[model samples]
Each structure stands twice: as C-alpha cells, then as structure tokens.
Target: MALDKLIGLAMLAVASAVFTYYTIWVFVLPFVDESNILNSFFLPRDYAIKLPFLLLLIAGLGVGTFIGNVLIKKAEKEKLKKSKKSD
Candidate 1:
C-alpha cells in the first residue's frame, strides 16, 4: 500500500538523519574546537556514548522481560492442560 510505503520511507529518512547526526557528534565533534559554536548544538561528548549504551541496556531488558513473560504463560497453559487431563 502507498501508506505503508510512505511510513517506511519516513522511518528510513529519520533513522538516516539520526545516524548522520550521531556520527558527526561522536566522531567529528571531538576534533572540533571546544570553544566553537558547533559544540553548543550538541550535548557534552560523554553523553553521546552514554545515551546509546543506556538505550541498548533498556532494549535488552525489555526483550528479556517479554521472553520471560511468554515462557511463563506457555508453561502455565501446559500445566493447566495436564491437570485437566488427570481430572
């Protein structure tokens, strides 16, 4: 569908923009003068590394929680089935 294509394109564009900005902030900015006005546009250099690390940590936790929940539910369902068979 056209709508789906549009959404995908928009997401790709946004992702590309973020990647370019982050690359610049991390790799290029450090070499730039600290007193330059460009430095003010970005957060302190330390956060550029910390932010992505924090995001990855949170995403990992979320995935782990989701998998645990699904496994727990599946085990409960199997246990219930077994109990019903014995009844």
Candidate 2:
C-alpha cells in the first residue's frame, strides 16, 4: 500500500518477468529456427542474455535495499516506542 512497497513490488515483478522471458528465449527458442517470427521478439542472442542478467542484478539490489530499509524503519520505531515507554 505504501509507496515504498509499491516500488518494491514493481521491481520484483519486472525482475520476474525478465527472468522468465530470458529463460524461454535461451532454452526454448534454440529449438526454433533463427528465421522464426518468435526470434524477433528477443535481442540478438548474446545481448538478450546479458541484458536480462543486468536487469536482474539491478532489481536484486533494489529489493535488497528495500528490505533493509523496512527492517531499519521497524527497528527504529521499536526503539522509539521503548524509549517512550520508559520515559
């Protein structure tokens, strides 16, 4: 619901989609001829592979930072709550 969560989810969705597409392109498309229409949907074979890898790396970093931020916020909130309780 929050913007942070929405952004995180979007990043995750994009990563998943890219990974799925790349998997199919690399593993399944090999069986299809280069002349097939399906081949046009993807980049040249090498770039296709490299691009997805890069996207995944970026998405992974985003997700990791998001989770870290959420954890840190939670910890900060708990610390504040405890300090108030003791005051």
Best-matching candidate per lDDT: 1
Candidate 2 lDDT over 1-87, as tens digits, reads: 999999999999999997899898888988998889999888777886688689899999999999999999999999999999999
| Superposed model 2: Cα runs more than 4 Å off | 1-42
Cα lDDT of all candidates, in order?
0.95, 0.90
Q: How far is candidate 1 from the true structure (C-alpha RMSD, Å)?
A: 1.4
The sequence of per-residue lDDT tens digits that candidate 1 reaches over residues 1-87 is 699999999999999999999999989998999999999889898898799999999999999999999999999999999999999
Q: In lDDT terms, how accurate is model 1? A: 0.95
How far off is residue 49 in model 1, in Å? 1.8
